[model samples]
Target: MKKKGNKPLLDMLQNIAEGLGETLSPFCEVVVHDLRNPKNAIHGIYNNLSGRHIGDPATELGLARIRDPEFPPRLSNYANTFPDGRKVKSTSIGIKDENGEYVAALCLNVDLTLFQSFQGAISQFTRIEDGRVHEDLERTPAERIHARIDEFAASRATTARSLNAADRKQLVQELKKEGLLEIRRGANIAATHMGVSRATVYGDAK
Candidate 1:
């Protein structure tokens, strides 16, 4: 049972949830559960990503809290997927009354479909292992070195000039893999174009 002053805290959290949902917009869903009544525990739902509304029954996590007195105060960054295969990253925070018993919970679910699409695109474009020869029969070593660097930056959705130290190191590794680093003065040309010293490239090569 909720204590006498529990209503005010729950109401405050509900208001905070409403503002959170509004600020995060289309990608985030926020749900508030009133554990006092598990059958219709949803005090409010915002963004509606899951298509659940107020008066909806408590979710599995909420029910677990009710059953286990020692349930964690917060559970965060867990994975959840919808019926449509939309992926969600979620966090649940349990709220307690003055008696230290769980009385409510605030849950946030963030849809990762957009991010997943970007990840897939990155994987497709960055792949260099097609088991085919890309070496130009007539191109000079300098031209091939520059071309490889440019390709590496493009695959990562960035420009070679804007590549950071870490990016340059990775590029050097890829260059070594493609046998460009074995060419005479290949390391010097790469260092010059990449705005890094020859030693930096060699250090990364190791």
Candidate 2:
């Protein structure tokens, strides 16, 4: 162990870890490790996601940095796992002293379990059916049928309920040919719009 007394640098890293942990709250774990003391390198831990405590030994990466001077100063978005196999995305940053010796590290670990579950749910919810009818959900069948009748009546200079017998018979025949009289409760719907009995609408449709 180098056993350097760089309390200010370690304190700063701890402060940063605390702020970041609070900002990302309950999902991220931020840890500050004092590399000079390999046996008890964990100086401070915030959010405590991995269930590690202060005074824990240096991690593999931290130990590597302590031994090898040529190691990369930063590793970002690296894949990691917790003790129980929970997935994690981690970033490890090695802090160096003024003499260019590795002094401390600030690490961030983000728990991705919740986000992965959410992604799966979203994918399932948005899955498209391969074969489905094109449906008009904005209007009911009755409203569309009434609108069609009103359009047909307007062309004859009358309203749906004011059509003469000959005109009304022609309307029912045209509606039947268009399959409008084949819908559910077709005769009743036609009667309501034509101001006639359902039997009259059915008879006219034939």
Scored by TM-score, the top model is 2
Worst 10 residues of 1 by lDDT: 1-10
Residue-by-residue lDDT tens digits, candidate 1, 72-172:
99999999986678999999999887677889999999999988898999999998966788775788899899889998889888877779888888889
Distance from true location, Cα of 59 in model 2, Å: 0.7
Q: Each model's RMSD to truth, in Å?
A: 8.1, 17.3
> If scored against the real structure, what TM-score would every candidate get?
0.59, 0.63
lDDT of 2 at 137: 71
Please give the CA lDDT of all the candidate structures.
0.88, 0.90
Where model 2 places Cα greater than 4 Å from the true spot, the runs are: 1-4, 134-206
Clashes of 2: 0
Give the candidate number with the greatest lDDT.
Answer: 2
Give the Cα error of residue 105 in candidate 2, in Å.
0.4
| Residue pairs that clash (backbone atoms under 3 angstroms), model 2 | none
